[model samples]
Target chain A: MTPAFEKLQKQLRQLPGLGFRSAERIALHLLVEKPARLPELVEALQAAAATVRRCPRCGNLAEDGLCAICADERREQGVVCVVEHVPDLVAMERSGAYRGVYHVLHGRLSPIQGVRPEDLNFEALFSRVADGGVRELILALSNDVEGEATCHYLTQHLPAPANGVEVKTTRIGFGLPSGGGVLYADSVTLKSALDGRRHYE
Target chain B: MTPAFEKLQKQLRQLPGLGFRSAERIALHLLVEKPARLPELVEALQAAAATVRRCPRCGNLAEDGLCAICADERREQGVVCVVEHVPDLVAMERSGAYRGVYHVLHGRLSPIQGVRPEDLNFEALFSRVADGGVRELILALSNDVEGEATCHYLTQHLPAPANGVEVKTTRIGFGLPSGGGVLYADSVTLKSALDGRRHYE
Candidate 1:
């Protein structure tokens, strides 16, 4: 293959899921097998780069003013689902369960990884909470130590009783996933499921 | 996500191995998680598209006049390996077993799929054969019906006896791959392995 092809392959190999062989296959596919797709893919990348930006209000993807969710007046803007990333928000949306707006932290506080609070998108969320419009905060972060630390930081720094309106905070339930059996569930999940069990008639 | 992001995801989904969820993850990773890599990927695609082209002589990837393999002087110019694609040629080179050169056909002769000889890169190979320089043509194609048809067509139409060279044609062996056990091989592979068995020491 040509040098440019190899360079492209190397770049592709650095992506999240692509390995060296997968990157090579993709590079060969785009360059040699289907050369016509190269321009289209480049155009798509350029278009997305130029048109997509983070919503200043929610940290979700936006184009002009605000993201679709934040811009939608029908959505319950008062209930903010705090997620670690835009994909997490997308997953919550895909579940068809939540009808609230989102605040993407972009990352959690990971001291081992040298990711501090300043490295996250916490400023806008703090400002949003201070605005007193957010009635509730839903913690939809991962079930990890960093997620717990993030939740702790948020609750500690929250401007509670903003303008005489109490900002209620609730973490999403951590239990056995839907369709997961107790035998398959880990000990931690079993403990969480038992701790968060609801009353059954 | 924005429309442009979704469009990019759709384009990625159409690639060789990526599916809907993987494409979505890639798009989100590029546009959100690691936005810095987006321009790099775009630049790589544009650079590869602008610089890389098929070697008109052998249909291998090339930058300017000829591919590296076609231009190398140390390789055996009299021996040529015919493959269905550039990746196939790369595989041959990776085995450290091929010192000759390659002719990438780009596709096989599959009339059922409307893949005729005209759709493939056969003219350059035929011209090479007609030049009386190729002493042997190794058909390193797949072990499928289309591969057989392609081999038959090549043998039938090759400019043999050109300048009294008596150009020889060969099909690469189809047998149990190296390190592959007979018990794990399919019936067709077992049959081919049995038929092509060599004399034991």
Candidate 2:
């Protein structure tokens, strides 16, 4: 392979879900689909790279040192939603419900992966809490093993539950669809279904 | 939504397989998990865009004006593999089976899509063949309807079988796995199996 093609392939393989075939497909797309856009995409890539920076206050990406979330005057400052990653930030934002700022943990702890507390921005988070303006910290980590572990680890560093600062954890509201048949239900799902039943008016 | 987050969402949505969910996922990927790699990937994207170009002779992407296949002195001079796009060229190369030059058609004849002969490099191909030396034209277009139509259209423009230029086409080799059953086969695959069957000897 030519150096250019080799380099392109190597770089493409680094992206998620891109194998050799998909890399070549994307490369061909860059070549054929509005060839002029190639330069523009390049410009966008470089601009995004050079300019994108994490907000010191909220961990959201911003063109300036502080992310847009941190700069926004209307967003609730004292109630911060802490998430494992930026996608979580976007997801919560997409719901268009949350009015508070976000603090991205970047990742959760996994002992198998050797991720320690220092590897994350836990110290900064503790400092943010200790400074005393924040009233609530909503832990919005995924409901998976690592997320659970990280949440537990984070709680240990927080002010005591009685210290007047409320620390709440969020989980998805999920269940069987209304009017769905129970004949096809599995045991665990059925159990959750029965366990979660509420009284009607 | 903050301007930066909104802008980022729009760009990520334009990427392949990136819907609202996937786009948010990528954003999170950028925000978290080796965030350093995101900038590097963006840089590589920009660099690839700046440097990659089409080979004048065959239309494959070239670091220089000519692609590696076109520049190589060792490839068979009289044989050319005609493909609808550059991705096909790369796929053929990946198998490490063929050492021949390629001519990228850029696209196929799609009446519904309004793609015509003039939109492709047909004129250049004819001129290249008439200039003398190419003895074989191998059609490696997709197995789709458009690819078949393109092969027929391409064959119509070339010299007759008597001109010492043989016209041939190839299909990918595929079949059921050793332990697989016929009931699982799709219609098109079953047809391919029957069409590609060989004598037991």
Candidate 3:
């Protein structure tokens, strides 16, 4: 590989979901396989970088002032789903079950990893809640120790109830994934699923 | 996801080895998780685009002029190993076995896929051979129908021997991969390995 190719591969390797082999593949694809696509990708990256911004209300991706969800009048703004990252919010949206707004924490609380409440987008969420725009706070974070810590921190640090605006905090149910089998399910998932079992119809 | 985010994800998905989930993850990572990396990646891409180019001699990646292998005097330039793509050349280099120069065809003969010799870097390779720069040509292409067709095309189209120059053409040995077992080997690989068997010392 040449210097420029190696340099580009190095940068690509640092990107999420890309390792050495993947990076090499991309570099070769861009430089050798499909040279015409290179400029298009660069233009797209530049355009996205120039336009994409965080929505002030929910911290979701936005082209300008607010994200589509926060700007939508029909969405349940008061029922804010707090997620560990934007992808989680996207996942929730993809399910098409939740029409509520989102609060992207960007990351969960991880004391071991030195991530604190102040490091995340907690202040924006707190302000959003404090503005009396939210009534229900659904914690859709991960089912891990860090996720639990983040949920606990969010519930504890919520703005005190005022003007009859009592924010009802809740966590998403943890259970076996759809189409997953109990026989192959991990102990943690099985335990969580059993604990979260609902009444028979 | 916002318009800008979606645009970036669409572009990312078009790249080699990326899929829907990977595109979404990379989009979130770049726009929300680590925004700083986005700009750095953009810079690297621009730099690579501006600097990286096809080697005039071998079609491998080059910064300005000849590729490292083609420019190196120590390498056996007369013994040219032809490959279907740059990645294949990189694989060969990584193997640390062949010290000869390379000629990247960029593609193999695929009639169904409409790929032909004119669509590849065959002219440059033929010219290189015609110039009496090559003495031996090693076909390091894949062991498939298209690869065999490409080998056949190269051998048939090679410039006739002239000026006391007779180019020797050879094909790479096909066998079970290192660390692979006969039980797990595919029938094609097993047959090739058996056909290519050599006497034990």
Query: What are the C-alpha RMSDs, in order, of all predicted structures?
Result: 5.9, 8.5, 6.2
Per-model TM-score of chain A alone?
0.83, 0.75, 0.82
Q: Quick one: ranking by lDDT, best first?
A: 1, 3, 2
The alpha-carbon deviation from the true structure for residue A99 of candidate 1, after best TM-score superposition, in angstroms, is 2.2
Which pairs of residues clash in candidate 1, taking residues 3 or more apart in a chain or in different chains?
A: none
User: What is the TM-score ranking, best to worst?
Assistant: 1, 3, 2
- Least accurate stretch of 10 residues (summed lDDT) in model 2 chain A? A176-185
Model 2 agreement with the true structure over A1-201: per-residue lDDT tens digits: 456556766776676556775666555566556556555545554455556777787776776667778777899887777777665566566555568787878777989999988888677677777777576676666556777688788877675443556555343223444433232334454445434533211
Chain A superposition TM-score, candidate 2 = 0.75
Tens-digit lDDT track of model 1 for A105-133:
98888999999999999889989988888
Q: Candidates' DockQ values?
A: 0.73, 0.27, 0.68
User: Which pairs clash (backbone N, Cα, C closer than 3 Å) in model 2?
Assistant: A87-B28
Q: Could you tell me how far off, in angstroms, the CA of residue B120 lies in candidate 2 after the best superposition?
A: 2.5
Residue B91, candidate 1: Cα error in Å is 2.2
Candidate 1 chain B weakest ten by summed lDDT: B192-201
* Candidates ranked by DockQ: 1, 3, 2
Candidate 2 per-residue C-alpha lDDT over B29-139 given as tens digits, one digit per residue, 9 for 90 to 100: 554455676666666666677677777888878776778788889998667877777655665665455667888888889999999999997876776677665766666
